[model samples]
Target chain A: MSAATADPGNGTILRAHRVTKAFGGLVAVKEVDLEIPPTSIVSLIGPNGAGKTTFFNVIAGILDPTSGHVEFRGDRMIARPIRTWFEPVVWVTPSVVAGVISVLVYLATANADATALAVLAAIGLLIVMFLAAIVRPRWYLRLLATAGVFRSSRPNDMVKAGMGRTFQNIRLFANMTALENVQVGMHTKMRANAADALLSTPRARAEEKASQARAREFLGIVGLRGRAGELAKNLPYGDQRRLELARALASEPTLLLLDEPTAGMNPRETAQMTQLIDRLRRDLGISILLIEHDMKVVMGISDRIYVLDHGELISQGSPDAVRADPRVIEAYLGKPAS
Target chain B: MRPDIVRVLQPIVIIAVSLVVVWLLLGGTQQFMNFLTLGAIYALIALGYTMVYGIIELINFAHGDLFMFGAFVAMWILTVPLGMTGAVDNPLQLTVILVVVMLPTMIVMGLLGTFIERFAYRPLRHAPRLAPLITAIGVSFILQNVIYSVFGPSPVNVPQVFPLTRFEFLGGRVSFLSLFMVAIAVFLMVLLQLFVGRTRLGRAMRSTAQDREAAELMGVDINQTIAITFFIAAALAGAGGTIQGLYFGSVQFNLGFFVGLKAFTAAVLGGIGNTTGAALGGFVIAFIEVFATQLGYSRWSEVAVFTVLILVLVFRPSGILGQQLGERA
Candidate 1:
């Protein structure tokens, strides 16, 4: 199932090294390490407020870690804040020093034209700094990245690098039709740009037709065979969940992160979703990282499980091993009667 | 009446009333033609305000000045570069010259818009909303000052390349210039609608507007999409500016201030985030202004426009075509 991608030397598809996220004074995810092997289902399970979602966010590049780094298939996805220290020194220091000198010279010499000249130079330097920070030319990024001093990855970057994700609370474009939602998910795969679209070129029209067909096929896979024309907001709760899964699949991601995919479904729907999840790994050969509160689904489908309690990884192993571990039991069911 | 019935009849009733008023006040095709031409220009400029606001939820106070700058660009191309001071009678020659002037002006203004967005607004994207707004006003002032220093405060004469050929239509006068202006505006607007509705980048834009994080997770390059939005909006404003110079025969540094206010008013009236709404709002505003001036309240026209704006805000807050509550998450 995992034969589609070249082996990354290591067996894992994703690796997080001591990732920590702090929101002001509160630490949400603390020094958590995780790995997802090729074409495997890995579950992160714990009681509510155990930092599972925060850890999920850190891995998906939605939130930056307070420290440490994440790697995907041997490529660095994110790194620590080395640039925060290095940028000001290289970009801002000269401008500030020039500004200060200009002020001092204006007071000491009382020559307005000279002061203006100095101010203009300072402004020019500041413009250069602004361009550097905003434009972020490839050479500058490569130079810093090679030195292990800077690495930045936005969520789009992660998606382009073969990662796809769904939210705990569904985030569909409510006004868009179901088919359009799926087509938008295939944004990275499309090639027609503004010019082609404006002119209605043959290639653009052909791509549009192809994507519509592909989008409908995805909808059918999720058991939504004919609901593609309905607005996403108009779908029932169960169908919306399925539609979200269909959208995530449209990205052709090598690794998929499902944040509580069956969070609000009934028993029958949950069973269906669980089967779908299993079939996804078996058929599509994509690794999945899941956060689940339902113990039955986790224990039934996960190849491995990690337990988190109060932002700490308490135990990790095969699902049966985790179910038998005392630390996992203590985290979920409290200490034994004494 | 039932709510559904009221919803169905409301627009029809408003249209009937507006037609009666326009017929009684304007009373002539000449004045109506003026309304259409003015409406077209306003619609083009209003789109810039509506689109930028839709994508980023930024008011973009500097957009009006970008239109003014565009007018200056056209002026420079026509007067300084091409050395044409007056209208060319050859229709073929005029058409060619118009194309020559418009393309560069629009492209230059479009690039300038992207530059401003990259420099001024992108840095404050994550800052509090008010920060980018202030930066927009600051950009507006800088644009005004730059134009003033170079061109001076007086209104500069522009070549009205579009000939004022008049013909009688139903007991009133119609100018070829008016027809040309309206045709161009409608054509560009249709092109814009097709692009936004059918293009890949356009879908990315709509998704980003709905949920930025979700769109990013779908692999939409958020920054590039935003820059493109600014480019298209500014380019449309540039076209509007070119039309203004050709129609009115003059350009000024302060030209954008009042016209921008009216175009902004149009956007708010039609619905700030909806493109069709902005275009509709522009024409409706032109009708009201034309009616007011024709009825001998020319001095009070601005007062009338603002009064209507305040009323619309007070009553419907969401303008005519704004999204319903259920559409928003």
Candidate 2:
């Protein structure tokens, strides 16, 4: 089912420019540049400890790069610019203003009561600030951004912005039912607020029904419809993987990230997973970024491949070209006896 | 029966049997009425403990103090602005007053709870578990001291606004006020259960509690969900505080110390992360407390409660209806 026609947007869907992630003194990923085109399967392959997962995490917004940035569909999703350094100060603006006001009042009025009033006003403003942070009115967020105090995108932000991902270790909501798992993935799409749910309003009820139906459809797409009622942890290994995919798909992301989708699967299961991945992209027009250890699966499905070695991107090309590259071979298997 | 069925049924059966035993021990409707009211209050507080633990895994020691704040807020609302120091003869007027007072108290406490999570817990969310745990204790002390300073270290009387009405029921006199308190408490608990079990946001909360990272990946806002959890939990504590004042007729600044510990014990007894378990734990702890006092062991009531807690911990560390088996990760 690899008959998917290229979409209108020929521009890159995801672009990472010299992304690097460091853990304290240890650099996990270094200056990695990658891109995924619309309706294409791109694979990132590397040996253990080569930072493939770290790169995946940076793309997924699970971690911010020590330097560099990532753009999703032309929107910067991850970055640590100079302005971000002012975020903490922005949060403490109320206290600073309060302190300045009280001090100024004491200096100008020379009256203790005036200073006390100023202090009280400060407390009131602090409360307002706290509430503003919680409610996060759009204007406030815009003001923060304009003041260069914006935060990097969180995982939820990435998911809401049409990116979905699964973990290499299969991090499903294990205690929840498979159906509930998918429903949770549809969290962004559900429009009901807390009040609607608490009151069981008609809008909330209708939205819930619609969401459940759609979630079930996603489960069917992943071939886990019959097991919707079963707890996620109770599912078989292959089924759990499929359920995770279903959960990811429930968000209806334009781009999907699969970390070792067929990690522990037998050959037959591996073939089926590869076919499923192909079908997902072909039928739904969703771009896929895969991190795989299996060579045959990667070569068969990926339109383009980027190989990593020791936290650095070593090679990038079409499957056959990348396979033949000497650097990729050296990265995969240490340089042969000189 | 299938194991799943047994797993589901076991908790219900245990709660039922324990309730029956407690009922048998009460011996009089008056004692039973007291038990129900007290149990309802404990249940409300325990829910806050269990939910915070469920989502962020913090034993918010300050929660009990929040309950104390709730009572004080309600008391201030009643006496200061409303100037209500006696019961209203008209039921309609009384209810209007109750709603006016209770609604504001709940909202105030809810916002306070959200604020606490923001300043106290949210920053330490990624810190070592011990850091937040210690912060919680520190927050608890802060709340207690604030209340102590404001309310003064004395027991203030709340208006007995429900009126003195009693009737014969099951060979003992039952007060109308106690019954009303129980009904309201049970109603809130049921509302909470439905909210958590059926709502989309509730699903987000549960998924978040189970796996915060996965839930975030599914677009569940962790901070918002946790803040809501804190809000709801503290709101219930507010309700409990109001009930405690109205029933007991007086409120003290440190009233939450014993109540909070007892409620925490209940949450652990019922299963720390499970909502139903926490509520069940509340009623069970109430039963044990009432039984001790009823049998003339009021001095040993704390001992009885802790002994039961220890025993439950020793054998079934997951609590009475623990969901540990499902948490294989």
Candidate 3:
């Protein structure tokens, strides 16, 4: 289904220029200038202490960049905070402000000044909205802090925009079937309102049926139609990995960030996953920013490779060129056998 | 009975023989049927607890209280000028219409269950399991007192007083009240069974019950699915409450106490997380209690129920349908 997957956007879709991340005293990633052009397979390969996962975490919005801002399609990405209680109170602030302003105008002009009052009310509402646009997030952040959820919104929310990720260790629902796993990834796109679902009306039923069909379709795309009915945990290790990819694809993302997709796979499974990744980039229309420890898999699929040694990119180039580079070989093959 | 029929009718035969013995002891058929009817009612409430536990892996201690609220609300509605009492010749028609009218109220209780899961259970979702369970107990206490404060402690008589009419048998009187209660409870239970077994929400619930994260990854909103489970349990309890009030003819603020424990025990007996098992568990407990009572052991009926529960749990921790099912990815 990812066939002819032309880049949906023109020009560099995501540009991370001079991004650095520090953790108190230690620098986790330093001066990482990168251009992630749309719809291309790009591999981030490195040794154990390479900070590849850390870099992926930062880009996926799990971690904030210590310095550099991420610009995607020219629009600055905003990291939205997870849900909190104070959100409801934050929502009504605009309406409350509008009410106060409208009342003040009414008291000043009396009922005869209809046109002026309307315009004043409209302007007041607009101002409240603008203020809300600025303040709601602040309110949410404050609430999250108070709620002890932990956030440094600047780097976090910024990272989340247009970026999604999967954990290194498989975190599949042990009891949920394979199909349901993929369904959860499409959560943000669900059109059915909560009220409609509870009501169980014909419209809601129709929407739900359609969603189920779509969920089945995604599972099939990953060649997991046979395992769809089985619980994810029950699937063999390789199938579980495939299930994770299916789930990732369900997000319908522009950039697919894979964290060790073939970490525990045998050669056959690794080869299959590599092909899937290549097909994903070519057909699914997603720019692959991948982290794989297996050099063979990396070299087999990577169009361009970036090698990191100690929290910094040591070398980067086309696969054959990077592989031939003495510096890249020194980083991995160890001082050229002394 | 033929050998094939005997194999199929084993439990029924045992119960039939037990009924005959009870008839001899109680001096008749009407009393035996009364016991049977009461068992059916408890089974209804027990079924709710089982269904909920089966899906979300929650004990839902407050379910019994939700049922109690159902009875109270139904009583309030019936007592008001809105419900008519006089033209109640057909108890089936009257009771059916009454319970049917109570659906919205039951649905409201379901919403309340959803709220409990959100404000109470959601925060404790990541914390230790014991945390939310304690929260559930706290909620139950709050609801009981809330009822006492609003409606008072007195037994509120349900105004649509359908007179008890016993259908006389070889030895006793099977009242219209008992018949009506048994009929409605059984019908609703079957209806609920069909709804849960065959529906999409039911599948979502089963999935959530399995593994919440996996379910969430599948686009099943964990919170939404949990809420739906709560709603279903709450609605079931509400329906049970309405039935209890109609059957017993009064609803007390403390009605949930006994019913809640019984339902819990029923859930345990049926297997905590098995929906069909919970319903069957309820009936079994009721039958055991009814038989114990007939044997001049009425005072120890609750003890017998607990003993049976403990015995079952010792053997099968997952309960009757403990199939180690899931919802995670």
Candidate 4:
């Protein structure tokens, strides 16, 4: 855990140390260490079934690592703040006790006057349990979690923590308008509750207006300004890909993860996407971690690349160095035909 | 005209034409007012159904039961605690009682909705769609029996606490209570439209409905958004229940069962996922029911509503305002 925060001056924005993920008996991602420095584009390249997506899933908090840790901006992704045992006790013990007491009272009262008292007591106990859960000290909570009250960070938490991603396939909200899709990405940034929404309070209204303006700005950034009102499903293939990128950017992420951004694009669309990726790095000044199948895109854009083979990082270096490595070549193309 | 502008105006024109035709057929304003009041109540309930379906695609069979419980809650508050078994003559006292009863009922029902989602629907989120549908029916029965056990099977007569003052407009007499209910319903509908169109959480809801995975990737908390949707929908249902109690002066344990089905029909009629459409569908169904009853088909009103639902499914499956089949957004 201390290693997670060891280097503040190194400019590394994300660090995954010995990260491993397993599904049942199958080890999908072996112990892998990787780092993405600030304002740099790092590509993770591999052949099919190389576990790139699994690795992405782990870091993105979509899947929890069986072992090892992922730290983003010096914060661990999975935290066991309380002992595991404490959580159950805090959550369940009062209810069990109340149930027992209620049954005893009911029996003692012969279903009479005391039944009300028993109900009141049970409600009181439940309230106390809720209060304890909400007001307990962090250290005490962590101690309880250690006894098995574990809570894992989720993908939305990662997004709120300044990480954003797009899927391998275009996962844009197909039924939503392009502008609305981007507005959804701004969920964490906006602050309005149900009451505010129902009452149409001034603050909620102002926040809504600001979010719409920002959503439109994001659309413009993605070069889909005029198509903001168009449904995402109606967008062309290339436009849909860019719309996904726009939606991701609306989260105001410091680190962007793009998975196969150009998977189905033609040569012209692919080149255009490549340029947009370069511009994202240059203009936005945000660090990017990309998982791509196309070697040309990787070689042309990646400042540093990591090559995976059989769920293991076989090589890591600059584009030219990784391309020149015999192991990487063999991993991608296999042994020479002769 | 551009297609988008035409799309927006088409529904307005259709509704206007229908209203004019109904006006001429009814030959009187009183009947239309009655239909409007009933339509408002149905619209309120339909909004709940449409909202929950939009976000999670769950029918929430317990919703009608929630509305029933809301009526029961209001009844208890008025009869047992507030001691308002008869109509209050003082406007200020009436206002206070309405606020006291309505606010707590909405809150409690909203919380119950959240609880139902957490326990019943959330677990089956990833299961086959039919699984939740069955669970929803099960929940509906549980709620119905719970109410039956507590309140008995007899209809509880709700005291008409609302003022019965009538106002004459354009040779039509409209009760203040009816007008009030319609106004409240319209207010809520407008707020809902603005929220979904403009607010951040509303955007999250629409996105989640369209694509749950994509919404999560964009930092939208799918669970929280769904929970909020349930809360809002149930709260609206609660409001509708209160109005129903005041309007009809009686509530039965099975009140939700019939109303819930009607609301579901309304949702489908207005396009299940479209918010404003559900409201329109509710009013449309109300008009159909009222007209049928007036035309000496009182026994067949329910049949008529169902027939309309089937017709919509067969000819225009998307309902009146539904987008084209492949363009459901």
Best DockQ among the predictions, by candidate number: 2
Candidate 4 lDDT at B128 equals: 100
Two-way TM-score contest, 1 vs 3, winner: 1
Task: Please say which candidate is ahead in DockQ: 1 or 3.
Answer: 1
For every model in order, the TM-score on chain A comes to: 0.79, 0.82, 0.77, 0.82
Candidate ordering by DockQ (highest first):
2, 4, 1, 3
Residue A317 alpha-carbon offset, candidate 4, angstroms: 1.0
Please report how far candidate 4 places residue B27 from its true position, in Å: 3.5
DockQ each candidate and list the results: 0.44, 0.66, 0.20, 0.51
Grade the docking of candidate 3: incorrect
Rank by TM-score, highest first: 2, 4, 1, 3
The global Cα lDDT (0 to 1) of model 2 is: 0.87
The complex in candidate 2 yields a DockQ of 0.66
In terms of TM-score, the best-performing candidate is: 2
Which interface RMSD does candidate 1 score?
Answer: 3.0
What tens digits encode model 3's per-residue C-alpha lDDT throughout B186-302? 777766665544345555566567655444434454555666667777877777777787777788999998878887888777777666677777777777787777778999989
Q: What TM-score would candidate 1 get against the native?
A: 0.87
What lDDT tens digits, residue by residue, belong to model 1 across residues A51-120?
9988898888767789877777766555234555675465566688899999999999999999999999
DockQ of 3: 0.20
Which tens-of-lDDT digit does each residue in B1-329 have in candidate 2? 69999998997897688667777889778788889999999999999999999988899999999999999999999999999978898999998998988889998999999988987888888899999999999999999999999889999999989878788887888888898889999899999988888789899889988888778888898888888899999999999999999999999989999999999999999999999889889988998888899999999989999999899989998998868412534
**Positional deviation of residue A293's Cα in model 4 after best superposition, in angstroms:** 0.8
Cα lDDT tens digits, model 4, A96-115, are 77878888888876885677
lDDT of each: 0.85, 0.87, 0.69, 0.82
Please identify which of the two predictions, 2 or 3, would achieve the higher DockQ against the true structure. 2
Q: Tell me the TM-score of each prediction against the true structure.
A: 0.87, 0.90, 0.75, 0.88
